[model samples]
Target: MTTATAFDPMSEDYQQNPFGYYRAMRHEAPAYFIESMGVWALFRYEDVVTTLRRPELYSSRDWINNALGEFDPVPQVPSIISSDPPDHARLRRLASKAFVPGLIKKMEPGIRGLISELLDEVQDRSEFDYVSDFAANVPVNVTAQILGADKTIARNEFKRWTADLIRSGARSVLPQEELDRIHRSVNELRGYFTELIAYRRIHPGDDLVSALVQAEEDQQVLSADEVLSLTFIIQFGGAETPSHLISSALWECFGDPALLDAVKTDPDVLPLVIDETFRHVSPVRFLGRTTTQDIELHGKVIPADSVLLSYIASACRDETVFAEPDTFDINRPGLSRHLALGMGPHYCIGAVLGKMMCGLALGMTLQRMPNLRPVADDVTWLPSPWVRGLASYLVAP
Candidate 1:
């Protein structure tokens, strides 16, 4: 097996900008083994796709659990993203009903109004950290709206919980205090959802959580644990990814003068810009998978039970599949093939909602502020192994 140069995802250098490392790994060792993490990372698009397509051979039962450090008292149940076939399929099918494109489209009017309101709050300011002032707020509020928790939970409180929950994935490398905070966040989410689930039983509302609480198919329904598991993942997933996506799109556009000019001139290019941002700035860096059987690729044999990390961020920038992979080109024809939202049966359930939020937020923001631009040349990236997003993106209007 090819062993890549000391690969530590926890390193600050790698976390800041992984594209350079991804580029080297793609060429030198497509399937490299990281000794420290005991994981074989697939950097090539072909290899990543092959592994993602065959979940039976490469199970997901413990992938997310391994990525997100396990809690001490709280048992990690198999959620949709962390379950293998049959169970995964069942969970996805039932959970997906709440996220159907039609249902998400129904949320468009409300989401647009929400975005407008958020923009209004920042309108008078000459500059604002888009990540905090706007991007961050959009997803949590949308998630609250979806879960029917808007009225029960305050916006700032929900935002705080979502931020802490997303960090739970980095608990293994985090400081003791930070780790404890993440655990608290986990407990809070569990407690909140546990109570919400119980309350929803009495007062079912037209929200995703309520729907999942009562979701039934083929005379089979999701248990309370199942509902909690799905809600936990969906809550954060729905909150974190889209926020990063919106900020990343703005970052790319403002940084590229020509792209920004084009966008300003032709508003229709906004969708293309967002799609390309998904490829250029993949929010979720990589997803872990456990091998069910021996698999040979790139002249190496990966043993069963090995933690295989498919760097979808790397796959999205695979030179073979994407021409000028590093360059952010909105017109890239292969935009449809990017694995930012993931691939296979475990694809993001909130994909439709995510794209809509991004497009709406960006389109509205740019339209409202004709002179929007970046406040600095550099961005503060989130220092985490699981995602690639700005810690704060300062922008001026």
Candidate 2:
């Protein structure tokens, strides 16, 4: 029987090692229908790429939040992530100015300093939860700094909000309490950003929020609501994705002595390691899209308005694309092509910042605590299908 028939994204087995199931799906049923989730899943590399690139045919109007069943009625938020064409393009253009690589590079010193301080907190401890103690802190602080939030306040509040949003999005079914927390966090996030945007309007600074506050394209600018939506995306994406990337990369490196040694010796190897880790264990597993029209693929027809879950994690491991795709190799060719950060018009705007934060986090950790070792016997992945990440990893210095 094809694995597709029994596939469950939220299963414990899938959470631990989804690659085997992904392999079966790619080989046995390229375009499989998942009933529980009510979406057509694309498993192969080329098919996922086609779905991602063809924005006109596959509308992103109903994106991640909608797929996770966030809003029962799903209010139409003016966010770039869920918009198509002219609207998406305009939002992207304004947001892009603040996310430019050159601008991101300027923030490196502050980011590096923050990473150093976080590591310092765990120096005396023999063992600690890397995810909670270190990995989780980097992105929140950086995101807060970028948006001009006071680090003291943003670190705690954004951490909770980001955690709730991520936890809420990971699973399709959740307890009522969890759902309530999720909605509460969403409201708190919007409320916080609304106040921040208004504050930035009058007292602008050299931060992303202020930049978005002032950014104008062709005499058109972002509305307060638009800015709020975009900020929500950036804060959540920036905080959650990189923490997993950093923790997962270290977990992988800790398993291989030679790879760990190679990264520790050469700073350049750290980025390569980060890329391979992303390919090997993608933090964000699948992205959602809605079909704009009926389309036939692999002799099956997908109806219009149906949600499509493109398995990006599966695409990253497609044997047709990478040699020994199952193996983790930093030297693997075409590492740049991995879709962990996504592709096309909706490619991650904070990619530059995300990579930098991860690389710096890994590099500095290796530099400061070269004797780091994993204390866990088996990796415990978070119980969320949308994101593949460690819930907690114990490590010793």
lDDT of each: 0.83, 0.86
Question: Which window of ten consecutive residues has the lowest lDDT sum in model 1?
Answer: 67-76
lDDT of 2: 0.86
Expressed as tens digits, the lDDT of each residue in 1-397 for candidate 2 is 4376667886888878798899999988899888877789999999989888999998898785575465422245646878889889989998888887777888899899999999999967989999999999989898998889889867779898877766666445578888888888778777778888999999998889998888897998888777877777888788889999999999999888899999899998988998899899999999888999998988889999988999999999999999999899998899889999889998888887888889999999989998888886798898878888899999999
Extract clashing residue pairs from model 1.
Answer: none
TM-score of 2: 0.95
Estimate, for each residue in 342-368, the C-alpha lDDT of model 1 and write its tens digit. 899878778877888898898888889
C-alpha lDDT (0 to 100) for residue 278 of candidate 2: 89
